[model samples]
Target chain A: MLTGAETEVVLLSFQVAGWSVLVSVVPGILLGWLFARWHNPARALLQGLVMLPLVLPPVVTGYVLLWLLGRSGPLGSAWHSVTGGHIAYTTAACVIAAAIVGFPLMVEGIRLSVLGVDRRLEDVSRSLGRGRGATFLRVTLPLSLPGVVAGAVLSFARALGEFGATIVIAGNIEGQTRTIPVAVYTLLNAPGGEPGVMRLAGVSVAIALVALLVAFWLGARQRRRVSA
Target chain B: MIEMRTRHSVRGFTLDVHFESAGPVLGIFGASGSGKTTLLHCVAGLLKPRDARISVNTRMVCNRPGGTWVPPERRKCALVTQEPLLFPHLSTRGNLAYASGAKDALESDSGWKIVDVLRLKPLLDRNTASLSGGEKQRVALGRALLSKPEMLLLDEPTSSLDAELARDVLSLLLQVKLELKVPMLFVTHKAGELMALADDCVVLESGKVISQGAPVNVLSKPRAIGVANLVGVDNLLRLEVLRHDEAGGVTLLAMGADVALAAPLCASAPGKTVSVGLYADEVMLCLENPAGISARNALACDVTRISEMGHEVLVELKIGLQSLRARLTPSAAHELGLAQGTHVVALIKTSAIHMLG
Candidate 1:
C-alpha cells in the first residue's frame, strides 16, 4: 500500500544498507580476527580505536566523517587531485556514514565468535601440514561462520536505522540519500505526512524484528558449535 | 630419530633438557609439571624456547638465537594431544582429509590401511560431535597419519580414556609401530605404557633428565630417587629365574645369596634375568617365622635402617645381599620392638611380586 515516493525511500534504504554491509564485511572480519588472536602489546589500543564508534555520539561521528571527507580535508583534497570528484552529500556518503555507525556491532559479534574457537584445533591443523592462512580458512573461518552471518545482519539492521550520521553527512535528498529513517523524520514535520510516517515506521519495525530473530538463531547455532 | 637441546622458562618454572634418540618409538616419562609436554612442544615447533636446537630425522627444524627456524607446517611432525581435537564442524571423513595432500592420501592404499587399522570405515560419515571418546581418538589418529608425517608426537594420547580404552589404544599403537613403522615421540606418565611401547626412554624430574636408557634398564634401576617416586614402587630389582615349578604354578627367582622368592608362573626360562616391582606396603614383618603359613616367602632378615614417613614407618631389610623395604605402622614397629640391626622375618605372598619385562 506504499505510494511510489514512499516505495523509493524504502528501496534506497535497502540499497544503502546492502552496500554498507558489502564494503564492511571483509574489513570487519579482519579486524575481528586481529582482536581475537593478535598478541602484540599495541593490540588493545587498536581495538579501543575500533570500538570508539560504539560509544561516541552518532552526531559527533558524522561530524568527524564530514571533516575527513570535506572539500578542504586531507583525504578529500587527495581524492580531488586523483579523480576530480567530491564525496559529500551523495549516496556514497550515506553508505559511508551508515557503515561507520554500524561497524562496532559487526566487529564485536565476529570477535567473540573467533575467541570462542579452540586454539588446539588450529594447532592440530598446523601440525597436519596446513599453514596459518590455510588453517584459518579451513578451520577457524568455518567454525566462526555463524557469527559472521549474524554480525552482517545485525549491522544491516543498524545501518537501516542510522539517521543522525546520514542527515549530517549526506543531507535529506529524496531518491538518493533520504533513507527510511530520514524520510520518516521529514514526514513527521509535514502537515499531511502522518499516514506516511506510520507506514514507514511499521516497515522498519518488521525489518528490525526479522533481523534480530535471525541474529539470535545464528548466535545459538554458534554456541552449539563451540560447545560441541 | 630426534635430537634436541632446549631451555625454556615460564614464570618461575624452567624446562632444561638435552637428549638424542634413535627411535621406533621414544617415550618421555615424567609426572605432571615435569616438562614432558613442554619438551614435545619445543620439538613440534609449537613453542619457541629461549635457547634451543632441534632436529628430526637429521633435518634441522629449529635453531634459535639467529639460526634457522622452520615453522610447524614444514616440520613434518604430527602432534596428537590428549584431547581428540577433531574439527567440530567437519565430519569424520572431512577431518581425515583436511591436510594439504590428504584427499589423495585418503584414497591411497596406505591411507585406507590406516582407516582399516583404526576401524574408522564405519564412522567415516558420522559427525565428529557424535563420536565416542575412543572413536574420536581413532579418527584423530587416522587424520594425523594421513598427513604422511615423518614422526608422530603423541602427548599422552590415551591418558584421557578409561583403563580398558587406554589398553586398546596402546595395542593399536603397538600395531602402528610394528606394521606402519612410523617413528614416534610418545609422552606419558604411565610406566606400563613406556614398557609396552618405547624402544628408548627418558625420565624427567622437575625440568631435567634424571635418567635415560632402554625402558627396562631405566625403570628397573632408576638412578634418581625422583624416578622411583614417580614409578610409585618402593622396590625395583633384577633377579635371575632359579626354576619354574609349573605343578605348583610358581617361578622361583633368586633374590641373592641362598635366598629365593616365588612369583606367579611366567614363560621366562630358567636362569633368565627378569625385572620385578614390589610395593613396600605388601611386605609384612613378623617377630618369628610361624608354621603352616600359606604365604610363600618368609625369609629371616636383619633390619638395616628405619625411617619414619607420614603415617607409616619404613624398614630397610638386608636379606642375602639384596635390600628390601617394608612399610609398617609406628605401633607395629613398637610392638615388635623393631630397630636398626634387629632380626625379623619378612613375609611376602607369591602374587606380591610383579614381573616387569
Candidate 2:
C-alpha cells in the first residue's frame, strides 16, 4: 500500500526511465554497431569515451552533466538562445541524466551480440543480391535482435535506480523528478520515513531482479540463434 | 563467358590468376589452398584484388586502379559456398525468398522449376537449422538460383557431403547445367566433377593458372607435375571407343596404333573419344609376354623413360604413339634390370581402367 506521494514517485520514475530508453535506443544501436564493426585505430578511444559513465562515479557524472546544462554553460546558453527556455532542473534533465548513466550497458550488450554474428552470412546475403543495408536489416539485425532488446531493458532498469545523477542535475523535485531512488534518498534524512524507504527499496529490488532475468534469457536466445 | 586477370596477396599466400572462358559451366580446378576459392571470390566481387580486370558476359564488373568497381550485390553473380550459409532465423521458404527480387521469382514458373530441380518443395516450411547437410545445400542452391543471377559461382558446393551425397549433388548440378542452362563458374578439386560439368577448365597450382582448355584435354595431359600429382592418377588418357562387346560387358578403347585397351561398359558411341584414368600402381611390368595370365591385356612395349620417386620407380613405356606409366618398387626395377629403351610387356586389367566422364 503506497501513499499518494509514493505512488507519484513510482510513476515519475517509470516515465523518466521510459523516456531515457526511448531517447537512447537509436544512438545506442548505431554506436554499438560502430564498436562491433569499425576497423580504425581511434575506435577504441571513442568506445571508451562512450563507456565512461558506466565506470565513473555517478556523483561525478552528475556534476559534469550539471555543468554542461548550467545557465553559464555553452550548451545551456545555446539552448536558451534557440528556444528562449532553460533545460536544467526539469523532467527533461532527469531523463538526460538517467539515459547517460545507463548508456554503456546498452551499447556493450548490443556490440557483443553483433560481433557474435558470422560475417560470412552477410557475404552470402550480398552475393544473393541484398545490398549492405538490406543485409543488415534482414540478417544482422534479426539475428542480434534479442540482444538489442535485452540491452534496452537493462538500461531501463539502470535508469530506474539512478540516484546520484538525478539528484545533482534535476534535484529531488516532487512529482516531476522525484523518482523512486531520489524519493528514497529524500525520505532517509527525514524522521518517520523508514517505512516509505522500505517499500520503494523492495519495489526497486523486484524490478532489478526481473530485468536481470530477462536479459540473461535474451542473451541465451541470442547465443542459440548465432550458433544455429 | 567470363574473363579475369587478378593478383591478390594476403599474409603469405598470393593469388595470381588469368584466364578467359566461353562456358555454360566453367570449372576452376585446384587442390586445397591452391587459390581456387580465392579466384572465385575475386570474380564474385567478394574479394578486392590488388590489380584486377574482370568481365562477365561482355560487361566489365571490376577494373581496379581507377576503373569501374561494382559491388557484390550488383554483380549478378550468386555464390554457393561449401557450407550452406543459410539465414538461421528464417525458415527454408523464407531463406529461398530472401534476395531482392526473389519473392517474385518464387512465384514465377522458372522458380517452381528450380524448386522442382532441387527437390525443395517438401522442405519449404522446415526451419533451416533442422535441415540435414544435403537438404541445406539443396535449399542453398535453390536460394541462389532464385536470385536470377547472371552467373552462378559454386565453390566446391558438394565437398562437405558424403561420397554418395556428393554424387547426388553432382548429378543435380549436371541437371542444373543442362535443364536450367544458367552460366556457372564451378570450383572443385575433384577431377571427375570438372570433367563431367565444365565446358572449359582452368587448372590452378599455388595461385597461378597452370593450364586452361577443355576438361578432358587439360586433365588428360596435365601440363605441370603439380597438376599430375593433384589429379592423383599416373595415367589420364583420352582414347577413342573402338567397339563394344555387349555380351562380354566391356568396351574396347584404342590406346595407340594397333593397340586396344578393354574397359568397363560405357554408353559412349563408337569412334567418340572418352577420357579414362589409370593409376600407375595398377600397371605391372613383365620382361616377357607371360603365358596363362588372367589379366586382360599384355602389351609389348619399349621403356622410354625411368624416373625414381621415393621408394618406387615410374617406368614410362611407349606403345605406338601413346605412353603409359607403371610404378615399381626399387627392388623390382633393380631385379628386372629395367633401363630406358629396354623391351618389356606392360600388364593391365580391364577393371583398373576407370572411365572418367
Q: Which candidate has the top score in DockQ?
A: 1
Q: How do the residues A1-228 of candidate 2 rate in per-residue lDDT, one tens digit apiece?
A: 899999999999999999999999999988998899899999999999999999999989999998999778888889999998887889999999999999999999999999999988999999999898898889988888998999999999999999888888898789888999999988999999999999999999999999999999999999887777
TM-score of chain B of 1: 0.75
Q: What is the interface RMSD of each candidate, in Å?
A: 0.7, 0.8
TM-score of each: 0.85, 0.84
Q: C-alpha displacement of B297 in model 2, angstroms?
A: 9.0
Clashing pairs in 1: none
lDDT of 1: 0.90
Chain A only TM-scores, each candidate in turn? 0.98, 0.98
